[model samples]
Target: MRWSKALIPTHKEDPSDAETTSHKLMLRSGYIRKLTSGVYNYLPLGRRALLKVEAIVREEMDAVGCQEILMPVLSPSELWKETGRWDVYGKELWRVRDRNSREFALGPTHEEVVTDIVRNEVRSYRELPFTLYQIQTKFRDELRPRFGIVRSREFLMKDAYSFHRDEESLDETYKSICDAYTRIFERCSLTFRPVEAATGAIGGSHSHEFMVLSDTGESEIIVCECGYAATDERAEGAVDPHPCDEAPGEMERVDTPGMKTIEQVSEFLGIEPHKLVKTIIYEADGRTVAALVRGDREINEAKLSMALKADLVVPAPPDVIEKLTGAPVGFAGPVGLDGIDVIADHTVEPLVNVVVGGNAQDVHLKNVKPGRDFKVTAFHDIVLVRKGDRCARCGAELNSFRGIEVSQAFKLGTKYSSGMNATFLDEDGVAKPFIMGCYGLGVSRTVAAIIEQHNDKDGIVWPLSVAPFAVEILVVSMKSEECTTLADTLYTDLKTAGVEVLYDDRDDSAGVKFKDADLVGMPLRVTIGARGLKSGVVEARVRKTGEVSEIPVDDAVQGILHILETLR
Candidate 1:
């Protein structure tokens, strides 16, 4: 490839709207251009990078005995409706209408479509225990897309779904795909951790997220020294009870005036933040439930939803809270509540006397006991785990860090197979739903994550395996026949030697070519110049390590190949 014929529009300055490091670097390097909010156009260089990542994913998925197939991006609404996800998917699903007003969806995932395919084709146990995969584009209507391609609306993904006749087969294939995913990310040269994660909208019993540690990541992860790591929504912590030793006093109503929040009440009563009880009102499956926890603890909604076995749980509106508790938003309490269930955090089990809402405007109750003054229907661990919290595994303190989710593997069990009626006949002549598993790798997001972990001040330092070009030959003066002739010879020889090389024969200045070369960040940079040619040598620079060396002009092709072998 020659630079003069390539569309490498390297920019001198970062775009004004770019926020994350990957976003800015990609723009400056001319890899991608923004088409709209949460949408982008991958230029030639970006497309090459994406293809490289796709190749790695394909190789791994193929090595694991998975067959590749392409599914339609536009799926009929009937398929989603059959599984009851048509309404459950909500706004993230891009729903549209055809000429006759029939509904269709730009698929954010292929579970429904893939299951539909299997149900129609495979009707017996003889066709069981195989994985089907595709590397394709996906769409999700993100509410607030940011961080470049990290949360984009449309992006490339590699998704694989496996069907099995028995639990044993499912387990074996799950482990195999998990191992393959590890190898895939490792070959991409990423430092990542696979943590236990909640299934979220994916509707699975078990899942693990492959996360790349980054400060700019959207997800917060809790990691413990005992090797227990999980996303904050799913991470568990010890519930150390704080017993009340002081004698209980009679409950009394105190005039809080305009004070409503925990901070205001704590300051007015001269008590620590943890001494007060926090009351949260939520609508779980259309039933108003009051959740009580320590003043300093925040509710983990995911855990709360699972505890109640509800399809959806959201914070009650101000009107709903006032109507149910007879108090304003922040003044709701659990004492003497009517027509609603009350749930308390496990941390409240040991408390003897605590402060709660008075259930009146601008009033609060003091010296209130849990069992005596108020009772909870259930106690569960719905507390959000934070930094320094005791780990549920080994009692060590947890550490919090941000990470980008690059991929996920799920033990889907029979969630989809049962819902979609994807069943097969057993050898004993009994029909059963297929045991299933799902694995996904975000191809475009992986590229952004690679830049997030591998770039510096200049630009992206692409690892050799995924670099658009392994070697880029930059001629100091294209006008000089000597420099151009030597650069042409080296480029031809490198290509003939089975190396991915880019020749910069454009009529551009040395500084311009050098800046673009570093910005694009090929693995090895071979500089051909009049001065170096006179010395019977050329310069080679490693993009990742910034190590420069002089190579004999006659052996330039071999020298570059040797360097490429050492990287990635």
Candidate 2:
């Protein structure tokens, strides 16, 4: 590729709206352009990088005996309706109507479509164990899309689904795909961790997310020194039941005018937040319940849903609170409550005397004992884990870092197969739903995450396996015949040797050529200047390490080939 005929529109200044490093460098380096709020146009350079990522994913998926196929992006609503997701998918699923008034949707995932395919073809257990995959674009209408391709509404993904007849067979395939995902991310030179995750809205039994560590990432991950790591939603940590050893005192009622929040009461009483108990009212399947946690901690909705064994749990309405506690919304408590269930955190039972709401407006109870003053139905672990929390495994202080999700593997069991009637006859001549697994890799987001981890102040530093081009030949003085002839000869020789080379043959200044080369961030750069030609050598620089080595003019191609091999 020659610079004169390429669409590498390098710019010096960053865009005004760019917030993250990948977003700014991608635009300044001419890799992508914004088409809309959460949509983008991938230029030639960006497309090349995305293709490389897809190729790696294909190789790994194929190696695991998973066959590749293409599925339609537009799917009929009947498929989703059968699984009860047509109404449960909420606002993110884009619904449209055709000329005949038939409803359809742009798929964010292909579980319903794939399940319907297997239901029509497979009848007996003979064809029970198989996997099919696809690499295609997906659409999801994000409410507030930001951070460039990291959270785009439409992007490319590699999704695979497997069918099995028994739990043992499903477990075997699940482990194999998890190993394959580890290799795929390792080959791309990413610093990532595979953490346990909650299968949100997918209704799976178990799942693990592959996350790349970066400060610009949106997801928070917890890591312990004993090799225990997980996302915040699924992280389990130990809470000290006896956080303090204070003597019990008699309960007293105090008038607190306009002080309903924990912060206000803590300030007015000159007490620490952990010394107070925070009670929240929630409606779980129309049953009003009060959840108790320490004042410093927040509620984990995922854990709460699991504890209550309900489909969904939301905040109780204002009227429901008043009816249950005889007070307004923020003044509900577990003490002296009636006609409702109480779920308390494990840490709340150890406190001798704590502050709580008085079940009446403009009043609070101080020095209230748990067993003496109030009672709870049950205790569970429902506190959201944060940094500095003790590890449940080793009791060491847990650390946290921000990361981007690159891949995920799930043990889906029979969630989709049972719902969609994808059943087959077993050897015993009994009909049963197929056991299943799902694996996915974000093809476009991997490119953005690579830039997030491997970049400097200058620009992107692409890894050798996923770089757009292997080498770039820069001509220092395009007007000088010596520099032009030498650069052209090296370009031809490198191309003949089967190297991905980009030649700067345009009549541009030396500064502009150098700046553009750095912006594009090819692994190897060969500079042919008039001064270096006099010494029978050219300057070769490594983009990642900034190491410059002088190579003889005759050994330019051989030197570049050796460097490329070492990088891999």
| Predicted structure with the largest lDDT when compared to the true one | 1
Query: For residues 245-278, what per-residue lDDT tens digits would candidate 2 score against the true structure?
Result: 7789999888888888999988988877788899
Residue 110, model 1, lDDT? 96
After superposition, which runs of candidate 1 have C-alpha atoms over 4 Å from their true positions? 257-260
- How well is each residue in 1-568 modelled by candidate 1, as lDDT tens digits? 9999988898999899999999999999989999999999999889999999999999999999999999989999999998878988889999999999999999999999999999999999998899999999999999999988998999999999999988799889988988998998898998999999998888788889999999999999999999999999999988555667989889888888778889999999887767789999999978999988888788898898999998778899999999887878778998899778888888877776678888889999988888889888999888988998899989998999999999998889888989988899999999999899999999999999999998988888999999999999999998889888888888888899988888888998999989999899998999999878889999999998989988998888777777777774
How many clashes in each candidate? 0, 0
lDDT score, residue 378, model 2? 85
Clashes of 1: 0
Clashing pairs in 2: none
